[model samples]
Target: MKTAVALTIAGSDSGGGAGIQADLKTFAFNYVHGASVVTCLTAQNTKEVTEVMAVSPNMVKAQFEAVINDIKVDALKTGMLFNQEIISTVADCIKSWGGDNIVIDPVMVSRTGAQLIDDSAVEVMKRELFPQALVLTPNIYEAQLLSCMSIHCLEDMKQAAAKIYDLGAKTVLIKGGAAEGKNKGIDVFFDGQGYTIVGIKAIDTVNNHGTGCSLGAGITAHLALGKSLPRAIASAKEYVTTALEYSLEIGSGCGPIGHFFPLIESQYNG
Candidate 1:
């Protein structure tokens, strides 16, 4: 049987919890072959991101071209393109490739609410990339930024999802993981016509370092395997929830969810 291939154009996490590392693990667990184009390098662990250095725009283009030319990417996701130059380069490559099955995770805000990219890069992403996205997955903070409103409740999240849908993405998923109150762990999905509320029992754990990245990657992998957008999102949500249940207490700070939880479970049982 032929294998499906998914690609991740993101950054390298020295911590092995987020970005490219998390993305590849998600893809592998889904039984999809994973390819990567590293957009930036970060020197930090699960605790904090200390230093970040972006790959040159030319190199970003080269990496994207090399992978797209050789492998037939069934689906692809973009993570931390740190600058306007890199975002432009990636958007241009996708346009040139006439790429579809695109999942865009707007990684603008950190888990601690720090701004990761500058305002200018955010503008570039909105203008160049969002329109091309098959699904735009943004956490609550990012959703607030994009929709120009604060989200404090499920209603607010639904409003934000609708507003973001106007930004040209065919579908928008506003992650409420960081939300307070009873609605936490509930995500609002908007796909032009209507909204779907997806909720899972919230797992209490601090070791959710790559939940967003892994969720987006899992969706991409399922899309690569020929699932519909809603099915892909649902499956990915279940996967992330299970991964969170098996969250690894690896680092001193916030650790990472177990991307390979089934394997770990089997090993322990055996």
Candidate 2:
């Protein structure tokens, strides 16, 4: 039996479609094992997040040690490091043992537009963790937040990605879901040298709750299975597109894309 295990170091979303939930689902659907170290706990429903309490740095470190000692991680995905200490702790651990493929999703704002990270942790993530990531996946808002610049156009996205690269990430994926353009849901990928502009048509449904988390985890799964960076990212984007296409409207505000929608709800049916 061939089993691959990937670890997610992120927060828990009570809504069950994002965060640890979505990561685990993506892992299972991709035929990989999933483990997790929760960095924070959020009091969130389908509509919005009410409160978030970040776990202590010691606990975070302990969780990593436990995972490392028990099972070797094939790949790693990180999301929602809410504070400076937690971010620092994760970065240090990654630096110590970060040989495997790693995808860092800089989760800045929630689907409801609530801030999930502290302002103090931004600098720490840039200096400590971004350099260690195999790929840093930051959405339009997150890119703007990290680079401290307004993203008005695709050019702004490129500039933001370059600025983020200066902070140390080997590669930066600046998502263009919210970029100023006719694009309904196009995302851009940029390394230090050049950039690739990819266009994706919008999914008609409103169930886009955990698309970001699912995308990061899906990409990590492909990388763990030995896919190149570009291929892994392109494939992951396609996976998210299908999930969103079959998204189920669970909440009034915005719902979650089905991570296993391809299997659960066939594209033709749902």
Q: TM-scores for all candidates?
A: 0.99, 0.93
User: Quick one: best lDDT, which candidate?
Assistant: 1
**Whole-structure CA lDDT of model 1:** 0.94
Tell me the deviation in Å of residue 66 in model 2.
1.4
The per-model lDDT (C-alpha) reads 0.94, 0.83
- lDDT string for model 1 (130-171, tens) is 999999999999998999998899999999999999999999
Q: Least lDDT summed over 10 consecutive residues: which range in candidate 1?
A: 109-118
The stretch of ten residues in a row with the least summed lDDT in candidate 2 is 175-184
Candidate number with greatest TM-score: 1
Candidate 2: what lDDT? 0.83
